[model samples]
Target: MADAEGDRITLSALQDTQAIQGQTVILPTALGVAPVETTGDPRIEAGWFDNGLKRARKELGQADRSVGDERLPVLIVTRYLVDGTLHEDRAIYDLGFALDGQLLGGTRVRIRGLSLITRVPAASGQAKLDARWKQLHPKLAS
Candidate 1:
């Protein structure tokens, strides 16, 4: 996604630091679920992207509940992986804690930073989609 200046945050820059962890990141619920909604539409072939977001949301929700507070920061990790053959795909991760209060209406969270945790090359677009699906839905991977 692009920042206020309309510049897309480079995936490389996002993974540069561990700052995003343990910090609260606020996201509109709309943007949070956009990937999932677009993927579910039969007319769109972005199911992989949608599935990944769903998985990430589930994992993050579990982690959030475990923390016992809703006010915690949310971590979001977005990436586009390109293999040696130049094939590319994108994925997003949710790694923050749960918040205690409402996140809407001018509320803002402080982002500590970002870090790269995984980098895998997929043999095809489908494979890349599967990788993201696996990330968001670990149960399916089993």
Candidate 2:
């Protein structure tokens, strides 16, 4: 479904995501084994505008500007969950995961690459489902 429309993340995909919701997702940094939450479209999120038109544009002709990354909105626990932390600013980072499952008779998962953009305060920042972070930390990339 790589070329599928951004909205093509179907019920099956969502259901499949939820089915693994209870599973542990480990972020190498401070964030650790947090359960999976709802997911966004598993699109090749290329740039700032992670959702629609803008990202598509980058893919079409702006390869030079494109970070060429991938993202999926996997809501995991962060410093925000804690009442207070060292930094209140939001932070973004490239991340990865190691998932053990079965696809056709067994589970098949492949990662092309990963990278980190920036990081924000644990309380207010959000984590992008980028491949960069996972690339650096293989254990994190799944």
- The prediction achieving the highest TM-score against the true structure is 1
lDDT of 1 by residue, 33-79 (tens): 33222111111122223333334545544331223312211223222
What overall lDDT goes with each candidate model? 0.29, 0.30
TM-score of every candidate relative to the true structure: 0.25, 0.23
Backbone clashes per model, in order?
Answer: 15, 29
Q: Which stretches of candidate 2 lie over 4 Å from their true place?
A: 1-69, 73-90, 95-107, 127-142
Question: For residues 47-127, could you state the per-residue lDDT of candidate 2 as single tens digits?
Answer: 222223223323334222224343323323222212222212223433321222334443222233333455434444333
Q: lDDT of candidate 2?
A: 0.30
Model 2: weakest 10-residue lDDT segment is 79-88
Model 2 TM-score relative to the real fold: 0.23
User: How displaced is residue 35 in candidate 2, in Å?
Assistant: 5.2
